[model samples]
Target: MEATKSADVVVVCAGLVEMAEVEGVDRDTLSLTPGHDELIKRVAAAHKKVAVVLSNGAPVSMPWLADVSAVLEGYLGGQAGAGGLADLLTGKVTPSGKLAETFPLSLEDTSAKPYPGGPLVVEYRESLYVGYRYYDTAKIDVLFPFGYGLSYTKFEYRDLSLKQTGDKVTVSFKVKNSGAVAGKEIAQVYVRDVESTWFRPEKELKGFAKVDLQPGEEKEVSVELGTRAFAYYDTGSKDWVVEAGEFEILVGASSQDIRLKASHKLAGQGIVSAADKAKLASYYNVTPTTEFTLSAFEALLGRPVPANIQPGKGQFTMNTPLSDMTDSFMGRQMNKVMQNEIAKMIKGREDTPTGLTMRTMAKEMPLRSIAMGGGSLNLSKLKAILLMINGHTFQGIKALLGKK
Candidate 1:
């Protein structure tokens, strides 16, 4: 401490240790392990100009952030990382990298708690509510949010617009460099379903564009949104379906730093199957057997079910297994209809089983089962099955297939 007080400037290189970052080793805490935090605090108190260079892969709680002059994140950089840091520090390279994950104020503020459940089995209780999605939706305060990065220059956002044609949404906004130096800004677009029937995250990242702007230079940025942007995975239908309702378009530099907003109404696609409609009701926190009626199902499906179909006696929950439902008169009819429709959908597929049975396959089938030798598969049907089994969106499957 005494030696640092004599220096003109203090540079503290602090971050997680090797044990905390390894794959199999689980970190016990989100703190800067042991005396690192205290050391940084002492250095900041001793020197007026103190810059902290973090050298960890994951986010750590920084209690001394406000006391430091600057903080640079160097996330496990490789051989040339030291040289890159020197260049950034000396103003030879403008830092434009952003945080891909959120940094919580403390360990308790994070979504993942009681982490690393067991050596053999690790249960992911957080599910989709990970990182910024959890913090943003739960309204939890964090030290830094996803896509947050500070540059030497400043940028301004203005004139946000949302244009929709059929199922596509186009988001456009103007960005200007308001500071003295040239730098790049990553503009992010997040969408929120205002009145969805199913539960959805408060906001989801739909699109993002990065642009380099010279000082006083202005540019118009546009990001396109497809069906997946405003849709949810409907487990019953085995498809991604968009609910008809209002959607909020948010444009911002970071998840917590939303600057502009607009709303759009989507004309939802009608449901085709009775199972999907029931699942949608379940998503709305309603028991399908009690809250759902035959009339309502017909309305959503855009066609009437067989007149003979009737829910005769006891209460039925959406969680009721398909086999159990088949004992009822209405259930039996609905089951046959669903089976016929499914058969028609996969009529010509090579992988279509000779005898379709309720029995589970003896072994896991490879993804290539849908494809024939040197021939194309039914991509639409394959996408539906993929979404059903793997819970992946069409865009996600496309990414796995290396398609643009």
Candidate 2:
């Protein structure tokens, strides 16, 4: 502490728990390990020139961020990590990497908690609200957010414009390096459905452009969006579909740091089938037993259901058989049409049902095993296991594992 107080700069090297992603091991908290946090705090108190260098693969809560003079996220940078960091510190190289995830203010502020629950099953309760999506939508505060990064220089965004041509929307903007040092700036473009039939996140990243600029230099950045950019994955149709509505275009350096905005209207492809549309209506309203009625469904679908059909007394649930809803000739024909459409959607997606089943099993079995106390099966551990199973010598395996 005394040396830190006297030193010109105190560079604190810290990281997350080493057991991250290992079997039967998960971080107990988002904060830095107990001793590390205290050490950084104490050093920051004693020294005005305190810089923290983090070697974590994931975001960590930084309570003392305001107290530190600077922060460098090294991110488990292999053998050459130290040299690269040294270059960054000495002003030999400018840092350009951006955060791929958000850092919550508190662990509780995250979307899902009690993670890795149960020995045999871990439910993904937070469907689409994963990282920045949750924080941005819920208006939750965070220490840092996705796409956040700092360079030795500064950049300014201006001249925002949007244009639509047949199914494609193009966003164009200008980025200028306003600082003395030359560096790169990543301009991110996000889209939000102004009004949607199905629930949607506030805004989603659709495109980005990275531009390197010299001091006082400016460049025009343009990002194009296709159908998928404005579309949502509709499980009912087993296809991506864009609904007719207004969509807001957001440009930002980070998710929370939105700088420019524009709006566009989509005419919509109107490609969803009537049966699938009915299925969506039923799934969203009837099955959940909400106050939503057939009329509302009709309004959404832009058509009415068959006149002969009648929902039975009481609210319908998924358990209610299709036959119970109606027995008329039209109803039976609609069912057959739906069945054929579903078959068509499923066909050609996979060559064989066996291949599809095996692929799904291969993807899910590992998660199940990991939840059931079978060791973690991540890429790193898988590589290690492969080295061992291939009968390679220990030294050879170690050499292969060495930093690139």
Candidate 3:
């Protein structure tokens, strides 16, 4: 292959294999070893620029950081990894790689909790906070925190704007790739709520955008902020509540390395209670949900009972005792007619049993007549239909007719 032949030197970043020196070494002077240093040493001895292409299946322990000139974390590279690495090695493709997983200085400093030996009842003692949140909040040091990635070229971020438009907030910024090589940069957006009782990380990653740039090219990126993003999970209320206060929007390369930062407040109605029925009531119109329920049935008339309803059970009858003909006409007649038609349709079919259809029959049936009648069913009409259906006297048929 021309790729392998053209490269002056090839350094593969085969990640950390053995954390401890197995049976050969004792416990006292046990020092963890990095995996990439040997490859770097080999390539450096041969006098090459050194593409330390890091490839790993899972997170590896990078004990040594300063040895390698360039580091690329290639975890579980897909079908294109081999060829992609070859191109990057030969300088055919600019290395747009970055650290996917944070490289901790030591295993002890890592936020990774010790796994239980056996599969007993293991609890997530870490609670809601994990990864960089754990390290950032606990003040623990990490080799590289979350959202840490690298590009072939260097980038500079400037002009961060966090402005409120009505209820929502918009964040915008400019990124210019300053390095000579072309690369793809990821602009990470994080939010920090200063005043909150709940346990929270120093900052939380909210949104991200991947940007590609030619050498020295710059572009502006904008992101919109929704209310849910800025709020905290309140244990007392059992909901995400945005407390009335100032929230900071941090734009950066990683969770810890913030490049540009700005703050904004949630204006308008202030803090809305999760249990506030009045707030929820504001979302609906003058017509109650009963109107929507009725509209669904109104549209179902003359259509197929839609396989959802049972043939005989698709009717609605008067709920109360009917005092006069007017009550019977509206309540009983409407229910009986619809049921009679559905029953006929069910009897016509042989293979599909009527029993399975009965459970959901009423719900699935075309209840347009009842839905259009514009009010709740009276009690009399309900009893009459139940009595007829229970009595096994097809007299419930009258309820569906004589209305319109």
C-alpha TM-score for every candidate: 0.66, 0.67, 0.56
Candidates sorted by TM-score, descending order? 2, 1, 3
- Model 2, 175-282: lDDT tens digits are 999999999999999999887776566789999999999999999999999999988876556678889989999999999889999888887753455655564453
Highest TM-score among the candidates is held by which one?
A: 2
Model 2, runs deviating above 4 Å: 20-24, 114-119, 269-404
Predict model 1's lDDT versus the native. Answer: 0.70
Better of 1 and 2 by TM-score: 2
In candidate 1, which residue ranges exceed 4 Å CA deviation? 114-116, 270-404
Considering summed lDDT, which 10 consecutive residues are worst modelled in model 2?
Answer: 282-291
Give the Cα lDDT of each candidate. 0.70, 0.70, 0.56
Alpha carbon lDDT at 136, candidate 1: 76
Error of 1 at 196 (Å): 1.0
Q: Can you list the residue pairs that collide in candidate 2?
A: none
